[model samples]
Target: MRDFLPADKARRERVLAVIRERYRAHGFDEIETPVMEEHGRLHAGIGGDNEKLAYNILKRGLDAEAIRAAAEDPAQLTDLGLRYDLTVPLARFYATHRGVLPTVFRAIQIAPVWRAERPQKGRYRQFVQCDIDIIGDASDRAEAELVVATLDTLDALGLEGGIVRINDRRALDFMLDTFGFPVDERPGVLITIDKLDKIGPEGVVAELAERGAAPEAVEAFRAFLMRPQTLEFHPYGERQIRKALPEGAPDDIVAHLAGIGEAVAAARPSTGSGAT
Candidate 1:
């Protein structure tokens, strides 16, 4: 819905060049992934509720059985969808080409991705993602390297004075469970939380209500997100979380998220990217 004139394109190219040069200097090889991915793979528990924003491709070349299946379930009518991000297709690419890639592959992918989010702010349906993925490296060093590389790239763009925030996936899940979100609705709740900065607490509450979340759970989570003062973290986490967690939780209340602090301390440091 928007057009980039010559000035915009030139500025964009300059930004891209800085990022690409930095990625290469950090020893990341440029790679490409498909713009469209199989719907099944895109929906396979990645991208959280953002998966719901996928633009599904309708099934073509339908045989009689295929038509019947489509009639029974609308989801059966689609086989592929425009990818919401490069991560999923990159995963598919790695699986297909792992034999040729290095034992530890560091890749830089900059490309357009599509997502069907509500039109707001600068978040259009289409945007570019500059990604650095380190595959086959699980020592947590890879994540550290990524943060450093990203910071250097931003510095290359002459950007300064920004804060860095880290999200731990395991810790996020624990917090959601601690807030009493149903197991089935937790993913959507996580997605909503991701948007909290952009949409604010009230907006998140409205969206969760629209998504059919239990009223009490939504209110509890809103309050949780707005909690004040420092939490007294334990092996599992703060004592308050134990009170919120469901009966028969899979892990001990204080036993979860035990290693996160150590991991944060262990990550590679950046001159400017450290939290204040």
Candidate 2:
């Protein structure tokens, strides 16, 4: 974390003001959450591997022996923790206030969060995060609205060349089904796929094989990955989305994301001209 001088603080606040105004204009109401949450809730396997980065807050009045014993297991002594991200706390907030909230809640959260990290030039142990979430809406329109709002915010901030990469779990499941991967194994397979950028395609296939993934499924995925890639830029459109994916991608999933792309393009014409 770094201290902000008067000028810097003012400039930061100005930018945040724009973000808040844009988000509110899009119908997302802002809400505040405490910086701390119960330790058990923070580490209940919901935050994934990021849970390891949480800054635990020790319970008051713990003696020396108790502190040492709790070193190996933080949950033993830490009753609360500094939030690593906004998601967990938002979940708790919704659960506690669901009755009073509207049928569908559009939330805007802008706050500082802490994480234990090997800090470097741009990475920090603490930083401000801006998030917008729509709760209780399961329709594809929800997804479209989110994308459109984000792109609109980027436009509002005068930040050029912003793009979003859509990742739909439904589409992923359909692709996995086509490859013949079993239901129980999809999670592990997805974990490996998440590492594709860091490990490369060959490394991903190797790790998948090592994990005992279905051989036929692995071979099919490998072939899909090995297929010749075009160096062409695909503009935002339904056909373009299908062209970027492997064969047998579900029509509904493609249409769902295509709808989002179209909505974003309509909101900001120049900003929607890229491929992922």
Candidate 3:
């Protein structure tokens, strides 16, 4: 049997205790879901890439060769697989137990998920994900509160330089459409741009070009990425910015980003005690 030394067990238990205490203080109700889930729902709800990363299980009575073949090709797996992430499973849980939950539900889930990937330092095929998601309310305040809670959690964990980058897909879509990018190619563009920090400008431009974006469009995107002030706006400047969005675009996205900026600004203490 695998064994844990006394000191190791004590350290692990202490870590878990700290996590539970922080989550509880933030008013999150703890819940659990099964490790095995319906393969169809998990694959569909979690996302395509995530679906590929799921660990599938074969049932009894299946031939060993068939099971081995299925394992070789995840596409052939049927009906069930190990959980990939807590969010999709949580969504399933909420759908199943909606009637008993409050209109505004704040939940903390601490569970292990399986991923079919090579493991390395700080990366694991099976690891615990601690998450807090507030559902049923579309308020920007809720989103901002989540950001604040994340910052606080990092502080409590003694982590430094933990930057929480926030972006609204809606704002991104507005930018893409305004620049004349085809709707179908927007996801590709965003995915490329999202890697800018890691791969640098030239890498992002090459990826965008490879994905069939026009040279002009790629240049425009590069320009936008270089401009930090795009997100830096006072209330009046923000009002003017919203007015600049393409006609028929959702105003709610602009309002939400503006509210988030406002909330962050308001919460910024001049003393620099907790600016992060």
Best-matching candidate per TM-score: 2
| Residue 257 error, candidate 1, Å | 9.8
In terms of lDDT, the poorest run of 10 residues in model 3 is 267-276
List model 2 lDDT by residue over 112-165, tens digit each.
999997877887999999989999998767877787788788878888766667
Candidate 2 lDDT (Cα, 0 to 1): 0.85
Tens digits of lDDT, candidate 1, 204-233: 988999999978888887776566645432
Q: State the TM-score for model 1.
A: 0.76
Supply candidate 3's per-residue lDDT for 275: 20
TM-score of each: 0.76, 0.84, 0.75
In terms of lDDT, model 3 sits at 0.72
Q: Write the per-residue lDDT of candidate 3 for residues 178-265, one digit (tens) a residue.
A: 6667877775677677777868988988888998887787777667656544442233235654654545557677666767756755
Best by lDDT: 2
Question: Ranking under lDDT, best-scoring first?
Answer: 2, 1, 3
